[model samples]
Target chain A: MESGNLRCGRRLITSETGRGEVVKIEGRISFLGEVNPKEGKLYDGRSIKGKVLIAEGAKGSTVGAYVIYALKYYGNQPLAIIFEEETDPIVVSGCVMAGITHGDMFGKLDLRDGDVVDVWEEDGKLCLGISKTPP
Target chain B: MHLTREEERMLKGEYGEAMRIAMEIVVKVGEVLGADKLVDISHAHASGVSYGTIGEPGLHWLRELSSKGAKARVYSTVNPIGMDLDDPNKIPVGEQFYKKQMEVLQAFKDMGFEISVTCTPYYLRKPKPFERLSWGESSAVAFANSVLGSFTNREGGPLAVASAITGKTYHAGLQVLENRRTTHLIVHPELDDPVEWSALGYLVGEKVGSGIPRYPKPPQDEESMKLMLAASAASGGIALSVLEKVTPRGTYDIGDEERVEIDEKEIEELFRFNDPELIFHGCPHSNLNELKKINEIIKDKVSREFWIATSPKVFDEALREGIIQSLENKGIKVVKGTCSVVTPIERLGYKRIMTTSAKTYFYLNRKGLEVALVRVRDLWRVVT
Candidate 1:
């Protein structure tokens, strides 16, 4: 299990934050091409529905922002998003518009796929708790 | 971040619900990008109009905004849709899909957006030097910054829409003068054709990614420059490139920039391709001259399908000048307001395609289509 202070540009869009299993993708994702918003399934056959989707950042089309919106519209959005590198405007704008909670990994924590993670905001600071056991 | 009195009023919802929503999005994105304040913008262009790309959720989102009485405060233009709005039956899309596409289009129109439907807005109205703009569509951002001497970040569709409504964007990224400085100087081997220029841009974009590159010599022709900028934006997310003498003076500083040179052998690798089932042009929407050049190339009818995509304005001009008829007489299909990159070519049963635009090749390859890069001059010979 691993834990770290949450890092992001601004405050979380949603107030309610909870725990979920982490689904880590190694590369940058183009939501338009690499994701199916209707099903919330990635091109690799893994599901992002109700999980903390971790990735390097977004790539490809600017239409990617709307894909994230579609994910929420279909009730298949991720529990949260955790990215490493600079968050492109497409992802950031999409998360804001959809009212999804997202933060940055900040290269401080080593996370693995299937790791159970909990996130919350405290004293104007975002905190994360990681555990091996399923929440 | 500091906000003006009027900006605060808008954020506080003194300005309608649409303005409040737009202000929230702008300020949120501004904070994320570390923008200190908002800057006024003269124009905004919104992308993500294609039904094939955005699907039902995007359609609903636009309709929702229209219902909320969202209207553009500044002059705004829209990107290409999934099919031609004027003549939808000409495209092979289903009637239901066309209706959905029209719904999205109508919503944008209701929001006071001009139906330009072009990736290259510079073709319609060129921006002056150092003019602030809020533009989506990656290729247009690159072109506007590098070619038209405008200041704009590579905006997302939602951000551009927000800017259209609010008439402002965050003062960050390429909108800041210090951020637009050339960091790398790339010396390239001489290129004669538009395809070669596009290939060079594609290679450089992949090498530099988001970094600005300074080219010793830029393509002189409008088509080649357009292709170069489009390819770079497609391949590497490059928002701007500084051309030696072409880019306006005092706009970018290239002092002591790290220099690199690209040889001819490297560019030769990009031109290798197999025979193509279809030929496509206008990833960034063809200019009138490109349409004329294509019309001259296909003098006689050929066997394979040749498609030329252009904006509605260009298409109308071409139609009036008999360029469309000449191409159509040669069995070429000229489409308006959409291109192969944004549309789903699978519906047309086209698995393999060849194009001169590296931007088109890069995008279609990601969409699981077989794309071959070929020179525009060599297209007729190879395809036939």
Candidate 2:
């Protein structure tokens, strides 16, 4: 397993760990404009349900927070969210409201799309363990 | 993070579940942002009220908070909703959508939030300099920080709601004096027109994302500054911009900030546009002056839809001054409680939209609507 240390995260809602396949969007995502919470689909038509979503950070409208909440309401939320840099208020607030496991990896994590990953907090730090073989 | 006795009590559920949850959200966000203490705020303005924007989940969350006996502890106002609360026929959304939208509105009302229904809350209640505020709308936050010299981080909807319930926010980011220092300097060419000022702001915001930019010669009037601040925030996520003469002195220090220059050619290119099916104004909600100017320009009825979005307060002022009647006589539609940015314009079947505000153009483009940037003075020519 390929492992990486988390730079920052705070456990807000649920302390349960998350494990799922990975899906990475390269740049900042606007949850409101680019995501369809009803269908669990991204603008590029990728299903984010039960996947570990990683991106640079969130951008665009503040309504993005509600869109993320809608994702959870529709039972289409990601297993967890890992960001390269610090997350915006919309993303952080949504994760807190939806009980989604999230962390800022400080760009150290090098896992790719379709990789199986387990995300959890251990010893006050969020830890990510990625499987070697692609799913 | 240090919490006072009262804050601690609220967090510990002594104040009730609503206040407890609100304090928890504030404390959690403060911890995430590395805030050491919570600051008392004079006012809080909540955004993300639009049903088109927030959808069912937002409605659910607000209803839950209201049902739990949540009320605003501080003086609070709300942003615009999805449909025009005054007239349902103005927007194409059906009665079912209207009913859901009203339920959301009722939730806010039940929570003791003032039905301001405006993105530009600064116009309704002018915030004093050095006053701490918790405001959610991007344009309002930018204006509050940059124009009014009030302290506020660009908070999200949830945080703003929490702040309203608690009357406090984490003392971090723009609230702290050190973080407000300008890191970049942008020298703008002579720009008298409001549209040019907006374009310049858009360009500068794109070039310097999230950085506090200082303008050597900022817009002199409130209307121009409003346009600039709104455009900058929409384009770059900029919460603050230090104006040379306008911003209060000693609030920000420019310690060897990187410098850049914006010229007339760049501003000219922002006005490029073809024929538009609709002309929109007031992305940040037009002030009384802008409405009066439009009243003078449109002498006769035009063919295309000329829409002006403004706050209910401003609309009342316009109505009192007979400006609304003059505009309506010329077939201009005044929309309150909503604008092109937050409303679902794609459902309206309007393909092309033209506006003087760069912020409006940027957001509409993101919503997959065709938008063109046009000058306010030249909009009449295109519509006619």
Q: Which residue pairs in candidate 1 have backbone atoms (N, alpha carbon, C) closer than 3 angstroms, thus clashing?
A: none
DockQ metric for all predictions:
0.64, 0.53
TM-score between candidate 2 and the true structure: 0.92
lDDT of 2 by residue, A1-135 (tens): 345433334443444465678889888888977999999989899999988888887777677778888998999998887787777667777887677777774564576788787777766766677654544
Interface RMSDs of the predictions, in order, are 1.3, 1.7
Per-model TM-score of chain B: 0.97, 0.98
> Whole-model lDDT, candidate 1?
0.84
DockQ result, candidate 1: 0.64
Tens-place lDDT digits, model 1, residues B79-112? 9988876888767788888888888889999999
- Model 2 C-alpha lDDT per residue in residues B132-178, reported as the tens digit of each score: 99999999999988888889999889899989999999999999999
Best by lDDT: 2
Clashes in model 2: which pairs?
Answer: none
- Note the chain A TM-score of all models in turn: 0.85, 0.85
Native contact fraction per model: 0.72, 0.53
TM-score of each: 0.91, 0.92
